[model samples]
Target: MRMRTKAVLLIVFLSCLAGCGSREPSAQSPQAASSSHADSGEIVLEADSLKLGQIRTAPVVVQAAPWDEFETPGRVELDPNRVSHVLMPVPGRIRQVLVRLGDAVQEGQPLLIIESPEVSAAVAAYRQAQAELRRAQSALSKAERDLSRIRDLFANRAAAQRDVWAAENEVAQAQAAVEQAKAEQEQARHRLELLGISPNEPVQQISVPAPTSGKVLEIAVAAGEFRTDTSTSLMTIADLSHVWITANVPENLIRLVQIGENVEVELAAYPGEVLRGTVRRIADTLDAETRTVKVQTELPNPSGRLRPGMFGRIRHSHGLKPVAAVPPAALVQDNEGAFVYLEKGRGRFQRRRVRAGQPRNGWAPITEGLSPGERVVVDGAILLSGK
Candidate 1:
């Protein structure tokens, strides 16, 4: 029994040794270790491996193009120049509102009717002034006739010379009165014209016309509501044929934006639809509270798809600048973002994330991450990327 136990123990020991030998880690092999590290993105290669992979690196260069870029939040807004506010023309009850909110209107189109006493008063005053003018003219005619008869009598020696002089003075006084009456009549006529009423037809109602052609954006007063405040706006109308997309750019970044420059806008409501516009306006003063400058881009919106207060983003790029640039082979894109293999000396390559812009003319401007004069793996970068 003892001899059998010793032979069994030897067999067990040999079997344990064989299992340990089979479980040896692949790290023992240099090639296997390098392959494993290559899959991890960062590369550390030996002299032979570097030469075998045929890695070629090029120095980052300066490219004069749209090298600097940034995106900011934006919004759709109404153009202030095209916006019109309707105020109460006269103090009266609003008898009728001809248009509703969102309704299109034309210039000089009547928008409301008001039963105002001002119009009637103007017409009455005009008529009274006319009658007074007529009476003065009749009196002047009688005086002139008397003066002429007195002059003839004096010439024939049938009347005193003082009588002719006195008659002439009376005629002069009558003429002056007629002139004063004519001035009064003119004043009354002007008042009627201002009230938009005719002396021939006296009416208490006055129609208010639109000052400008546009779409009615708001209505503050309703029909039958008496308004005495003519200074307060009763409604708002704006020309929606063109709209302004505004974005508040930081005070530091305002230098990149200017009037008449083109910009690309994207709205959240319409994804994947890019709208292009020109910068038509920029605030002269900066906001003290927000420290931002309001910039507006005008876009032709004949279809009226863009509405005010719609949120979006504004992308602006300034003139060409000297920025770090690399070739397309140097850039590697994955789920995270675009990156490049930066070549450090001594067969060492480091992976770095880059803010690369659109590729242009075999060069991708690197807005961030890489710098000019730095070396990056351009050719055979795929070998270092390890898939």
Candidate 2:
């Protein structure tokens, strides 16, 4: 029985030894050790492996580009300089509206018609002036003939000298009256012209023409409505082919905005499309309540896709500044934030955390944690990231 117990003890001891041996870790090969490090986010690729992975490296360049920029909320607005306010030239009742709001118009195009008694009175005065001028001309012609006949009679001693002098005086008076009548006629004609009434045609309604070529933005008059306020606007027209993006920049950053500098514009309506513009104007004064300065950027819209009141984000680039930059594709984001792969040594790369600034033209400016002349993994960064 003792011998049997010894055999069982021996078997137990062997079982324990086997269990401990199985629990011990196996020695890792060099490839396995390298792969373990790579799996922990420390990628050490050999030159051949990098070639097979199609990895590309580029030196972090010191670039002088638009690195100093600030984004401000803005909105598209009609360029006030290009806007036109169509006002009533005279008090009249609206007889017809030739165009509607938002209708494109050319200069001198008839926009509306108004029936005004003032227009009719102007035409009547012009006609009366014409009649008076004709009458004066006839009188002057008669006086000249009389004066000639009197002079001939005096030379033949058939008329007195006093009568000849009186006839001369009468001729001069007639000439003066003709001059006066001509002046009145011209004055009347100008009045008719100012009223937009043709002197040759009978005046019925005054046709109001557009003073400028633009799109009608507002119409305050309707057909049959009497607009007696000559100072009030009848319509508002705006040239929308070009627009202004008005941004209220903070007072502190107002000095950064320089007129004539190029700016980038992005509208909420069209995502991923960038519109280029130039800083055209800046307000001389700041808003007292908001403590902000108004900056205006002129944006051309040949396609007329941009409309007034559209919200936009304006990025004003003051000027170019030297900064460390890398290809935009090198940036990778994860829970740790934006980062790039640095080529630490030959056939080796390490992940680096970076604070990226605004990107321009497929290049990203590294605001922090990067320096010029360092080589970074531009292509195949994703391969390292995935591992």
Candidate 3:
């Protein structure tokens, strides 16, 4: 009876154990199974036992591109058209310099006086021409009166025809002398003009005058400075109503820079200030040494605040168009090339190649290899790339 009772108890315990196992999974095991299922769709696993393969992913929208415009160091330049160098035309000693450095001058205003033999000779020639003109006029008048009297006498038969003809000839000679005197006067006037002396004035010395209305930028000549035809410089003047900012752009971006394109310029001397400009010229050839093309832009300096030789930075857009752009942080470069990853799903990404374009205000242009409105892994690309 004791053995049968013990065998019944053992069978009951076995039955209970089987029933429990068939009813449900344990709490911990079900939780782990659910987690695995959740990770299945876009699973990035580092399990040593699991193997995975690469897959084609949806296209990614990149905010960064390789199409950024190239930049080169540049400086402000004096506009060639607005600059004039005041130099003495003939060899002379600078008797006096009338203007100082930075003095504003008007066109044709005399800045200095130079005493030279050439100027004195021009003045003397002009005076001699004037005296000769007076003498020729007196002679011509006397000859005309004599010819008129002889013609009257011939008409009345009191003078011979040959005598009257001879008087007419003398009158013609005097008239010719008058014309010659007038010609000489004009020649002398031009000579004085070349020496910077006015024809109507008695200027004993040559005057160095300003060619244009502008401020004197440099003064190399002082009182009593000896100047010659080959003198390096006397003074340099510049019209600062406008200036030029020349920038060198890479050869690849030369096409983007066109005349009339707007640009923003910033000077190092004037921080936090931006000047406006427009493209004026684009170089036809690239510089061999730098492999860049020069572009010139004009900036208005109505206030005369901008100066030459100032360092400047230029900014402009290539105009907006459809381009592939991804966040700047999303771009990854390596030995292979530039690439970005697209997020097909949670924790999933696929690498892709792209060509970039110009970047403005932190947004870059994608020249190719991307479309608009595609989701890309920007913040977590590095982490997702591991998967």
The best candidate in terms of TM-score: 3
Candidate 1 regions with alpha-carbon error over 4 angstroms? 1-41, 44-64, 67-71, 133-187, 190-195, 260-262, 271-276, 320-349, 353-364, 368-387
TM-score of each model, in listed order? 0.63, 0.65, 0.67
Name model 2 segments beyond 4 Å from true: 1-64, 67-71, 136-180, 256-258, 316-322, 326-356, 373-387
Regarding TM-score, does 1 or 2 come out ahead? 2
lDDT of 2 at 12: 100
**Whose lDDT is greatest here?**
2
Q: Write model 1 residue lDDT over 19-93, tens digit each, in one string.
A: 888766543677786777777655677777745368889999998866345578999999899998888767899
lDDT of 2 at 2: 100
Across 1-387, the per-residue lDDT of candidate 2 in tens digits comes to 999999999999999999878766554466688787877666676667745358889999877777457889999999889898888777888989999988999998999898888887888898899999999999999999999999999999999999999999999999999999999999999988777779888876899989899899999889999888898888999888899999999988887779998888999999789999999999999899999999999999877889999998999765788889999988988887899988877777788899988777778888898899999988877677665
Question: Clashes in model 1: which pairs?
Answer: none
Q: After superposition, how far is residue 171 of candidate 3 from its true place, in Å?
A: 3.2
Model 3: lowest-lDDT 10 consecutive positions: 49-58
Clashing pairs in 2: none
Candidate 1's error at 247, in angstroms? 2.0
Task: Return the candidate ranking by lDDT, descending.
Answer: 2, 1, 3
